[model samples]
Target: MSDIEDKKNSLIEKMGSEIITLAHGSGGKAMQKLIDQVILGFFGQPNQGPLEDQAIFDLSAYPNHSIALTTDSYVVTPLQFPGSSIGHLAVNGTVNDISVSGAIPLYLTCGLILEEGLLFKELIEVIADMAEAAEQAKVKIVTGDTKVVDRGSCDKLFINTAGVGVVNNSLNIRIPNIEVGDKVIINGDIGDHGVAILAARGELDLQTTITSDCQPLNGLIQTLLAEGIPIKAMRDVTRGGLATVLNEYAQGVNLGVLIQEAQIPMKTEVRGVCEVLGLDPLYLANEGKLAAVVPAEYADKAVEIMSKHPAGQNSCIVAEIVEDHAGRVVMQSDFGGKRVVDMLVGEQLPRIC
Candidate 1:
């Protein structure tokens, strides 16, 4: 190996501990070690030898393109989890946002905040996982920033992503376009993301095989659009899960929504976790799923088109828009009882995304 390579490895060996230190954030050799062994090693510059402060894109390649811009932050603890990492969540979270707005995600910019005393190995794994996710979503992380703070000042790590996409103006899907008699369909099981994070914390001392369903939904949504399915509104089931999304649509349109408990899809393990914790799955969070409002006639077609894709194989119709009880969402239990699915008073799982 070259003298510099031997020296870098020697530095890593002499660190003694796998955890980060104040020196790693001091803009010195230790900091360079952290950057070389963690960040740049995973997300390497393609055409340049080193990273620059900014990235330039040539939008002129796409003539008459409508652009969509979105930014999101992810602060999930246990940066590495069963199915995803904070980096993976950051990319998918931003891409999904632009996708729901009827746009094709193109590029992204990432900003990371690292806390001292975190494991250098963990940071490396997070960035590598993120690179894989961006590749899968067909988006590029063209620019990024990183900052390290003293221990306890921040979580182990937090990621912020700003995404840009090209929107097809011909579709023009928006919430206001929702009409009475519209049907609500969800892409997959709910509560997986929240429950996964909860389980990773190990506070509940529960053991199950449930992993976070954190993934990019743009591909599935694009399939629906390509099939010419009529969509009125679409919301990814995230922070407040299905109930919160339903409430948003109902209140936005000043209409009522009725959902069937039996029809709502959820993983068996997720349901069991909620039952034991006395938490309502409807109010939980999801990462890789979405709920959409489509015309009644096109609901079945939408489900069919979505089912053909692996990401949306479990898509199903769960609710319908009604005019009677305007601005409210009611759920019918499988036992034939009805109750209001109200907005959550507070977050069920903080730092989930």
Candidate 2:
């Protein structure tokens, strides 16, 4: 076995606990083990073994057509924010999730829980926003369900969306495609959605005019694919942020990832809030960003295509897969020091989505 494999095995052996804890949910070592031993170990499939942000199944030999399906729920508090509202977030989140899986999101089903005494005008506004976002994303709300609950039983609104899209081809983007030398690319600034919500809720002291980066990314992914760029896998870094997503990739591929903190895209205002709040931007949440693992040879082409698109204009190569530090994400700080960038165990800003 390689040196790194030996080391990782030894580390796992030494973790002497069988009981569950909140740290396991933190997206750190504890969570990693829980998923590896409990979830992935039992249910993982050959092609769908925890790689990619989503699973890709083969249908080439079966049916002539293939489909991609995904679901997501948005429970961001305050219902509305500076740049977008929970309505837009719910729709975009589901659309982007399916899009990054290399599918063309075609239809969505929305389920909403409305609290009693909700302002009728506000409900209409939210639906209007959802319609506008659906139009922009080129998807339709073909079906939906609505329910009303006591004022104290439910928040202002909670939205759950399920989406389906046709896979243009049988090629699946699984995480196992990530090799030792693949490049990591992020679409744009991180933590805008989380910080924006926090600011709107008066959770932060300082703020600038910044909006949530909530938007559909299917168009951007379509553009990238048309360019014939080789993307090993794709994921929208929403909850649990980029760090958690990278850690998920690392475990799936059994490879280590080293990212340069300097290369991560974060807006100045978001950075300020993270600093004041003592939160690592890596652990912060983002709504409209995506992480792509590309073959090293095609990294440049991928970045170029991404930069030309509106949602990915600031795309940059943040890191590369490595053989060492297996199942871990390490970051090279600006000060020339290295630190383990693990996932947050609990929600950093809960109800912010």
C-alpha lDDT values of all predictions = 0.85, 0.78
The estimated TM-scores of all candidates read 0.92, 0.81
Candidate 1 on 192-224: residue-level lDDT in tens?
888888989899898988989999999999889
Q: What is the lDDT of residue 81 in candidate 2?
A: 90
Span of ten consecutive residues with least summed lDDT in model 2: 37-46
Model 1 stretches with alpha carbons more than 4 Å out = 1-19, 26-33
Cα lDDT of model 2 by residue, 25-76, tens digit: 4557855664454333322334543344443333454355478888888778
Prediction-by-prediction clash tally: 0, 5
How close is each model in CA RMSD to the real structure? Answer: 3.9, 17.3
